[model samples]
Target: METGIYLIVTIVNKGWGDTVLEASMKAGAEGGTILLGRGVGIHEKQTILGISIEPEKEVVLSVTYPDKKDAILQEIVRAAELKKPGAGIAFVVPIAQVAGVVHLFHQGSQSNSEETK
Candidate 1:
């Protein structure tokens, strides 16, 4: 089955997960999941008082339909300033199948039914 679902994966500096989430929602995404992580990019290497510190990161996962994928990604980029070095990165992966998101499909179908009624 072709679900036409895409997963928008966004990785940004720690504490910016909420910004991504809100942007995704504003672009029509239902919701998203945020996970804590740590990594250092070439532009992110730094030292604090002679001590090196690994940068903390937030990984945001937003599942959305094809129609909203581009808009959601653009919003995330604008909100997170991803164009800046070391700011963050966002990408999309097409999902062949998914589970536990029946509510989203159900709501879409309900609206379609109402429109036809």
Candidate 2:
């Protein structure tokens, strides 16, 4: 059995990172950082009038407890509908150690993302 922290990576069309992070938070995740990326798959590119068009993608990276990894991953897949091709993909990588999060990386983050209304 894998132990220690696990990194959850989710890649989807632009603007979907937020949705994936939201679902993870509800499943015991602290938060995630989003990065912009481009896909290079055969079906990812399209041409219009001889011009090439590439779809923008969002990559979300987050760390969570190993025990909660499965739940968080499941929620992300369900929320992002990754089961369908071309929607997106998600995976987990085991981590040996993590540092520099002492400043702030847990429970409080959920409130920080909450809207004040």
Best-matching candidate per lDDT: 1
What is the TM-score (0 to 1) of candidate 1? Answer: 0.84
Q: Model 1 off-target regions past 4 Å?
A: 47-52, 107-117
Whole-model lDDT values for every prediction: 0.88, 0.80
Instruction: Please give the lDDT score for candidate 2.
Output: 0.80
Task: Tell me the spans in candidate 2 whose CA falls farther than 4 Å from its real position.
Answer: 1-3, 103-117
Q: Give the per-residue lDDT digits (tens) of candidate 1, residues 1-117.
A: 456578999999998999999999999999999999999988999998999999999999999888899999999999999999999999999977666676556545564334333
Q: Highest TM-score, which number? A: 1
Measured against the true structure, the TM-scores of the candidates, in listed sequence, are 0.84, 0.78
State in Å the error of residue 86, model 1: 0.4
What is the C-alpha lDDT profile of model 2 across 1-117, one tens digit per residue?
Answer: 122467999999998999999999989888899999987455577889998888899999988876789999999999999988788899999865455653333433444323211
Lowest summed lDDT window (length 10), candidate 2? 108-117
- Prediction 2 TM-score vs. true: 0.78
